[model samples]
Target: MKKLYHNYIDTFRGLSLEVWWLSLITLINRAGTMVIPFLSIYLSDSLNFTLPDVGWIMTFFGLGSVLGTWMGGKLTDKIGYYKVMLVSLLGTGILFVLLQFAKTFEAFCAGIFLVMLVADAFRPAMFVALSAYSKPENKTRSVTLIRLAINLGFSAGPAIGGVIITGIGYQGLFWVDGITCVLAAFLLLKVLHPKKAKILDVVKVENPVSAYKDKAFWIFFIAMFIFGFTFLQYFSTMPLYYKEVRLLTVLEVGLLMGFNGFFIFLFEMPLINWLENMKNSKTKLIAFGLFLVAISFIVLNFTSWVGILIIGMLLMTIGEMIAFPFSNAFAVERAKKGNQGEYMALYAIAFSLSHIFSHNVGMQMVDKYGYEFTWNFITILALLGVFTLFILLKVLKKEKNT
Candidate 1:
């Protein structure tokens, strides 16, 4: 046990102080992100909107994400990540607070759209910041460390959010989320001041390749889109599953969701550290992760047993631990060919695109066909992502050999 503890501690030994600060900022911001997880529920139960109405609102949320990420990428390349991140954090905080005033369907849709537009811009900027803050050799681990903080915050958010919802109603979530975002922005200002942090523009390509022209990256984008589309169901449909199918209470659902974050917190960094040292093929690992996600969905069909939910969540969490950090590293590496902000923007856009369609599609599918059908559909999509990523792997290898 001592040996295990030391090894886990060793994984974090060499990261820069800036990277730790970045992770701290992410933790603070994400801990307040209890709004998205329960948004659909709030729309459906609290406001008495139909599922399709909820779907449309969520779709608008995705559209905002797409536009926000695109704008963020452009601004990051032109100005710098620091300013963009600072502005984004403040904007999103204010927007979340204002959003609570919108109660009608049209009003809520517009509110969410505006909120996400500002909120998602932070993504590409944050990626740029990560690149600026990290050493090349430590980049992947830095990504993992950031993800660890995100999951740690996520683990706490849902439980606290559930308590808030149960005690004070959903309106309370907005205040907490908004306050946290603003607080994170203040913290960012205090720690990551341009002069004090000495942030560098590290990689300078002699001839920068355009991210738009990279065929391999386009393929990667597609696979990432599918992965995001499918994985997002965890946030979108899975909670509904817990509520309707399992008949679990809101607190129980929150605890169950928090389990995924907690599990990743406990295991992901050590796993990432080991995988990096083993020199394993990143593409293969990602494909395996997709396969596990497919299995996670399909397993629900095999048994109605409530325990299957735990098993499925475990599989999904493991898959996420494998897939996300390596995928993030790959995007960063690819971005070296051109503008880091541009390439990372394209990467962020893929997931944002998923945000646009996945919730609406999943909700509509559930409404039309049922949960069983929806799970099957998502399972098939995940398998397709696995196949697409393998193709990307082969193409990358061919390019290297040529």
Candidate 2:
């Protein structure tokens, strides 16, 4: 047992201080987003805004993220990832603090929009930096480690936010989120030294715009967008749906989200490795995952019991764990070297856009048609994602033959 423990410690000892710091930064940032899952409740119950109004407010947040992600990628390519991440973290922290004083719905929306803009801008830079700093052999594991950190933080953050909101109210949640962001910025700056790279060093391909011409790339991007359309319900609508319709307590909702993070922490690395070694049929795993997610939602439609909901959430988490990282690996394989930032930016934008549309559409569908309709709608979206994956597999085969 002693030797086994030592070996485990030795494995992590190979990771640099920078990689560790980056993971910490990711955790902090994700912790700040804990309030996001419950934002609809905050807006409707605490602030007295209607459901439709919350949807409109979220549109601004999504718009800001869309622009921020694109600009962040370009800036990382030009000014380097360290600078971009620092700016994003510090700026987002200040915005979070400012949001506390927002009196009107418009003011609250604007504050959150700016916060998401800066916060999301940091994501691409962070991912690019992780890829750049790690050895190629350890790249997948490195990314999974970062994700694990984020999930761990997320697991705790939402539960904490839920408790804080139930105990002290929404303002307390904002304060906690703001403080975490500032601390994350400080830790990142202290640990990650900004290294300036020449334009040539940063821009290896020179023409990142050409990636759009790749058919496989478009298929993957579209599939990811559809996947996001279904997956986003966990953040946007699930909490509100459970609280309002199923009458779950805040603690129960938090516990459900915590379960999601726990599953990812336990299974993500082993799943990634297993999927990577699955011969040449990686896309089949993605299709299977999408099918699982769709089935999970369909099963959810019949359950008002908390136990059943938990089981469905576990299935959804399994699907997410299988699909998300593999999709990223697939994108990287198809991308031109040195243009990863642009490709990932586009991919991230798809997710952001999906969040915007799905939240708005799902909220309206739930209000008009009912929870069953919304679940069915998301199921169809997941199935569409599966169809796109099949198309991508065909495209990959053709590319190989060429």
Candidate 3:
């Protein structure tokens, strides 16, 4: 028992203080992430938009994200991550407040597009900042640490959001979310102020390759896009399923979603630490994670028992814990050999594109063919992603040997 306790303690050793501060800022920003998780419900329930309309609005959200990441990547390369992050956080905070007032479909679409554009710009900049803050050897663990903070925040956010929805209404979610983003921005400004902090740029390339020119990376990008598409259903359609089929209250649904975050918080770091020691292939682990997520979706089709929801969420959370940090580490490592901002931007864009397609496509599938069919379809797609990852693993190995 003492050995086990020490192992857990050892898992957190050697990270720089800046990484911890970055994680804290991420936690604060994400803790107020009440808006996105419940956006579909808000649009459908409050504004009375049709499913197709909701999907279109979400597509706009993705479009903004895609452009935002691209723009942020270029800006980070040109100006630096500090300025990009400051602008993104402050701008996103203001946008959220204004977005809540947009009632019409057109107005809401524009508002969400602008909001995500500004919000997602933070992603690549954060990755760049993460690279600057941590040593190469600690990359994956540092990513896992950030994920732990994100999950911890996520676990709390939904529960708090549910209560806010119940007590004051959905509008309250916007206010809290906005306030938190602004708070995080100020906190970042105070602590990691560019003048006071000298971040070592760990990733420096003499002649960096563009992300678009990398063939193996594009294959990996596709797998990540599919992975994001499938995993995101937990946030988008799964809540509606909990509400409609399972007859769960909104609060119950929030708690159920929170379970994923809580599970990740508890198990991910130790698991990653153990895996890191094994010196296994990152791509293989990611493929395995994809397989687990595929199983998570298919499990829903096998039973209607309420216990199955917990089982499915557990599978998904474990898959996320296995996949995300390694994927992030891989992207960062690859960027070290190439253009850091460009490579990380492309990585962020893959998930952002998935945001474009996941919510709308899942809703359409569920609406047209029922939830069972949708689950089956997503399962098939996820398996395809797993196969693609195996291909990437082979390709990466070949490149390394050459």
Candidate 4:
């Protein structure tokens, strides 16, 4: 028992101070992530937008993310992750302030687009920074450390957001979020200097276009996209369902949203470390996570009991705990030399593009066909994920043997 405890402790050992600081930056940034989770509710209730209109507005946000991620990745190789990360953080912080003014539909869509465009860069750039700052053997844990920070912050954000909505309103939510972003950027600027330290001294830039040519990565990307569509329902679909069907209040929805992050914070790093220690069957682990995600949705369809929402959220959190960090770690392993940023960016596109499709499909179905059909469709997507990922594993195996 003592040996096992020591082994678990070792999982967190030896990551550089830079990695810890990066995670701290992420925690501060995510702690103020008050807008996105409540976006669907805000649109429907505040703006009085129709379900379809709400879907498209969020879809516009996704489109901006797609572009932002692509640009961040492409530039990180040329400019370095440090600059990209700083600019993204500072730029997005200002945009959050500007977003509060975008009350008109066209203005709101444009605001969301610009916000994601500037903000999403932080992700791929951060992935590259994680690779640069941490030892190769401890890569997974380094990423998990950042994930832990983000989840911890996410757990706090909605709960605080719920309180703020009552006292300060939505404007306060956006302003507070902006302040956190600028604060994180300032911390990064004041503290980090990896170039002088040579953490990134051995890097070499690969052909930026090379990621698209990798058959195995393309296969993984497709499976990731499908998995992401269902995995991201909490942001796009579930909030609306809880509001319209479950009749939950904003505070109740905030608690439910916070539940996912709290559960992830409680379970993910330890669980991921344990899973890695057991074996390296990453694809199997990911597929299993996808299966669990599908089952969470199925639970919703089968029961109207509010208790089921908690169960569903817990199950989905477990699945994410299993899958998300490993997914990022595996993508880092697959990068060619110094193109880590680009590869990580492509990996991010899986979640980004899902925003475009998942919201539109989910909301339209809910409006036209009802909520059950939306859940059923998500189940089909999840099953497809299992099948697609297995094929990706085979491709990966073949690539390795050659």
The weakest ten consecutive residues by lDDT in model 4 span 200-209
lDDT of 3 by residue, 364-392 (tens): 89989999999999999999999999899
Screening candidate 3 with a backbone cut-off below 3 angstroms (N, C-alpha, C), the clashing residue pairs are none
Report the C-alpha displacement of residue 136, candidate 2, in angstroms.
2.1
lDDT of 4 by residue, 228-303 (tens): 8898787767988888889999889878878787777756767887888888678888888888888888889897
Predicted candidate 1 versus true structure: per-residue lDDT over 13-57, tens digit per residue: 888899999999999998898998788789999999997798779
What is the Cα-based lDDT of residue 384 in candidate 2? Answer: 89
Ranking by lDDT: 1, 3, 4, 2
TM-score, each model? 0.92, 0.85, 0.91, 0.88
- Clashing residue pairs in candidate 4 are none
Deviation from native of the Cα of residue 97 in model 1, angstroms: 2.4
TM-score: model 1 vs. ground truth: 0.92
Q: What's the distance in Å from true for residue 166, model 4?
A: 3.5
lDDT score, candidate 4? 0.84
Candidate 2 residue-wise lDDT, 1-90, digit = tens: 899656545445445556677888888888887668787788888889987788788888899899889888788777877888888888
